[model samples]
Target: MKKQVVISMLGTQLDQGFGSARWEHWRPTVALGMHEDFLLDRLDLLVDERRYAKLARGVSEDLAQVSPDTQVRRHDTYLPDPWDFEGVYATLHDFLRGYEFLPDEEDYYVHITTGTHVAQICWFLLTESRIFPGRLLQTSPPRKKDESVAGSYAIIDLDLSRYDRIAQRFQQQQLEDRNLLKSGIATRNAAFNRMIEQIEVVATRSKAPMLLMGPTGAGKSQLARRIFELKKLKHQLPGRFVEVNCATLRGDGAMSTLFGHTRGAYTGATSDRAGLLRSAHHGLLFLDEIGELGLDEQAMLLRALEEKRFLPVGGDKEVDSDFQLIAGTNRDLHDAVGAGRFREDLLARLNLWTYRLPGLAERREDIEPNLEFELERWSREQHQRVTFNREARRAFLDFATSTQARWNGNFRDLGASVMRMATLATAGRIQVDQVDDEIGRLQRQWRDVEPPSVLDDLLGGDVAQLDRFDRVQLEEVVRVCMRSTSLSQAGRELFAVSRQQRATTNDADRLRKYLARFGLDWEAMKAARTTSGNS
Candidate 1:
């Protein structure tokens, strides 16, 4: 069985002889019935010098008579006043600094019954902070109605979340934290919402390197800024946020820009200069497109991250900067490591908390909300309000969600589209004609980027005889037909003007014969296109 050990403040007044047996009846009543009712292997008493000076010896002697086997050791602790918060805290805090607990051999507890309210509060703080490492035991005197036995006692833990109110406050704090990360943008995407909640938790607790991976314009930079803002609000960082896009930095100058340079370090280095890393001291450093950094730079960066110090370019002495790293990359770091382009160790360090944000295409459900967000931004920037007409809003949303619209540029495209329409809107209202004009412009821009003919493969050498005009037309015809659900829909679009004029329009027959002219059919052309895409 593990031995029981009790730590308490010396009950100076309770130890004096008051009545025939009244002294033995004192609460915490350590002098009487200790071995009988309150059994313990050892009793560690905290004795206040001035308060217990006269009665300290008598207190120890009286305890030995009743609890002979219990080893009582008294520590000389001094406090100006038992009720003074600072005095009691300093005395107890210093006592615990040198005190040792043998957890393997004994079960221990703190007896809080004898101390003043201030002392009790200090004890509770120490225990909750884990400096005490023991449960608190409170004792009381016997009640007048039931004086047959000793007083009652209860053990109270300081884990506040066990109570309903504290837990509710914690939940409210979490909701507020989520709003901070979202930047007040209301979104319904389940995956994105979950990611925001997780980021909130990680940002508040950790300062470790974090990696944000996603496609371009997928809000990685935006999220990094939000994190910096939140941390700053929480007083977690004292320095400014320093951001560098590695993809835009080139050659040897990139090194000096990131790690600073000393005088006479290089031909262009005329004077000593501090770099972005130093600027991020005691703050956050956001490295966007980190995979674009050179091998030499990557090696030095890894060293700085590991040691919290690094030698700058052309400098012999090392400089130190304690900064949190948040790296953003669109590339697959694992693939880069496998290809020997990225360091495995650096990847491992940054991979601690990786969050992959989905692109606009993946979160198409969010387009409507973001569309309104863009309009609101335009309103702020231009100092004028812009509202989409009912018909225009429906038309734009339909096109944005259609299969024909590939949001290749993700949020970038959406923002630009809203900006153009807002700019063209007459008298702060985006009409249907403005939406149509923007859609047409976007289609032409997208059409120019389409690849060269898949026709040469399917149509053989006959494809060579066709001019650029016929070639572009045939490619569009084939692509639209493959995507369409039925031949009639494809025919209606291909011959929109002429089919509308004819009294009895044979749309599918026209489309079939049009395919026959190229010596190809719908099913065969779709199969060949799929094969080409795979290759």
Candidate 2:
């Protein structure tokens, strides 16, 4: 068992006793030793005045008489003003700092009943900060005059983990916050769910600008709005959420729209404009497609983000609008910077908390949940319930997760597919025919956007010498080679079906020979594509 120790201030008025009658009257320090349940092993008393030394000794003697096992020690602390919070705190801090603490062998308690309110507060702070390293011990006097002077005591432990209800409440709050960040979608992608959890914590704790990078229609804009809503729900931001597609802002109009403009600032300026930044004061500003911003606009945006103040277009004075920024981009800003199209300083500022959302095809496991969400949303909007038949649902899911279903537009494409099928459903039931039709439409859409042909550059118009069959086959083979990292990987994908039929197959050799028919090699094809890209 650890030794019990109590540190308390000497109450000059409350602890006074005279000769034989001292035992009859009640004293707080003496009563501390009177209780059998709180048998103190040691008592350290704090005294401020030389005049109180005699009373301190008397109290010590009384405590010794009540509890013979208790050892009394006196600490003389000088305090001219008992009510001076700073002085009292400094004195107590120095006293606790000088004392050697053995927490493993001893349990310490700081008594808050005897000192002035300031000293009591100081002791609480010291103990709570673990400088004194103890729990708080508060003592109350007897309620009735006829009651014993021992009164009652309570010990307060500051470690919150010891309390079940409070800890569970905090845990539940964090869960709700993460759910709110995800818009309660119940998404099934493990990596995506973990990323959302991290974002929830950061969104609540920080006001730094976040950069969301992904392909178009990958939910960057919707995620930004959800972040704004979460912060607003927590009362972190008071103003409205202002959003703008930076791709739509161009030339001088971009400046006027983002940083405000004065009347007669430019030829098209008709009246004073507050701009999106000013409107987002004390709130959140989401700039979607931020990579599309010009170099000059990027410079101005960097200044606004850094100083929270910027000069509007043709304005003399700078305006202030403190807002959190969340920037979204489908393009890589690093490439843009190398191309001299984006400002390095601005990209550095926005990259503090960057998140890359995966495209829908990358997280195909979440497709079913998102599909349900889209259907529910459509029902709410159209005021008509729509669901897929058993066979139709299975068919759509099979195709949706298949390698052939290219979700190039991410969630937007998935939502559109769901919408089309729901609209075409008869009597709120989507049949197999409806799903099949939607699948065909999606396949056609993706096929139409396939990479353009590179045969003209590769062949150099060989005087229009080849048949259509050879031309089509060679074009596809070159496209596959260009997309692949190596000859073997490209051959594996191209001969996926044909190679399976052969017991012994060298796909790389087969691919090399096939390319040689068009007078092409793997390295030359890759080089051609690289040259085309750089040019």
Candidate 3:
């Protein structure tokens, strides 16, 4: 005869101390087999003897109209408590000792019908303790009212041939979920799409360290997450993604934080701690602002990368961690190297899969879509729905185009601008006036100083040969004066004689007429005399 499978009905009240009473009230009824209409026929209801009588009475009283055999067995005989693993296993061992329920090295199954964490833990312990039947079955809680509460089950066949493959598949599914959650912000733009594709390829195809270069707010971290997600989705990695801002990793704290330290590693190192690298073992480690890392830390990082080995800050033993690296920075690594601030060898390692993200201004086409997305997000966050007026849209475009704003702050600035406008509008629509005003305010805030002009340039030149003329004519006169130093000297030198050649017809008026024709006057000449005594 085939060995009988033992199906255990384990029920416990969910913790209600945290104030989830609604989910707790139905628990006692469920435990008492009051919902027998919900269970399958083959399951055995196990309960403590003292509670069994009360549960049996309640079930018999309330569920008398249901089938007779559906009632749970109520015996006054004492059974060892199953709250602890040792006690539970002893009880089960005695109950199934010489029975056909025990499988002959195979065939029998142990099915657990409970969703509580304690039950899951107990089940795991039972398997580990070698008391569980050949196969383990688990059921998930019903998701809908019409769905059967008989529970969804899984058979952990754990056949040696397929165990590795099954475990890998399970881990892969978990990683995919994590990646999806973390990469929700990434979009399908050409740049981002290309970035994602490269990330996917790197995660699966290459083991090279990746460097994400971009200005602040250009989504370097987000891109890193996308890469992680793609890898996770492809099941190429089984490690958790750990992020660390090198800016925060400082001084003595750096060693302890990155590579971990043993208990009493330092004065205050009370207990052993696993550093971020170890925590990210078999995973991705994202280092943001990696350029901020000190030379010593850089050496440590280089060592880690080179050998996949590092000693904890205060610990003598070197631990091994094999993690894919993704670093991000707004600084120019090459410039840093040239300036003797970064190690060239370390940079060489990081250069293998580097990508520079385009700034907001460089990708103008993406601005509107990013704006719309941010506005919608802001509106949702503010608990309001807002629409952009046509003029508002035009005004935003105009403002964006009119200035050479670095948009170094990128999407963050845009999001903040939209949020501020939404707050100001309060109404359903964002007016063009508000956008214009906000842009004007930002321009004033970040406005560049105007450079000195050509006029200033000229004024700054030599003033030794300056001329007297109306401000309007000063420039031209100065040019002429620069060529010829004195006005009287220029007249005499250019016009042949100082006064004029003597006229044969010696009329003073005729001489004056001749002088006037040359843009000179007898009065101006007398003034030039300035009395012989002064000369």
Clashing pairs in 1: none
The true-versus-predicted C-alpha distance at residue 238 of model 3, in Å, is: 2.7
What tens-digit string does per-residue lDDT give for candidate 1 at 1-535? Answer: 7787878887765445554564446536453334345576788888866667656666666667667877878888877777889888988988888988878888777888776778889988998887887778777766775454345677777767678898899899888878878767787899999999999989989999999999988988888988998899899998889999999889989999999999999897899999999999999999999999998899989999999999899888999999999999999999899889999999999999999989887887888888888899989999999999899999999998775576767888889999999998999899999999999988887668755467867877787788767787898998888667778888888889997789999898999999888787877866875787688
The models' CA-based lDDT, in order, is 0.84, 0.89, 0.64
Give the number of the best model, judged by lDDT. 2
Residue 142 lDDT (model 1): 67
Q: How many angstroms is residue 56 displaced in model 2 relative to the true structure, after the best TM-score fit?
A: 9.2
Whole-model lDDT, model 2: 0.89
* lDDT: worst 10-residue window of model 1: 27-36
The global Cα lDDT (0 to 1) of model 3 is 0.64
1-535 per-residue lDDT for model 3 (tens digits): 4423334543434311123343324333233232343332333445555655554454334333333444333323334554566655555556545344435532544555442344456655566555655566654555676664332445676454567877888778655544453244434357755655555545667767999999888878877777777777678779998999898877889888888889988899999999999998988999999999888888889999999999887778899999999999999999899888899989999999888887776666667767777877887787889888888888887777543454647877777788888888846888988887898777765544434322233444432233433333544433333344345444444444534664532344444454444354544444433432264
If ranked by TM-score, best first, what sequence of candidates would result? Answer: 2, 1, 3
Question: What TM-score, computed on C-alpha atoms, does each candidate reach?
Answer: 0.64, 0.75, 0.49
Better of 1 and 2 by lDDT: 2
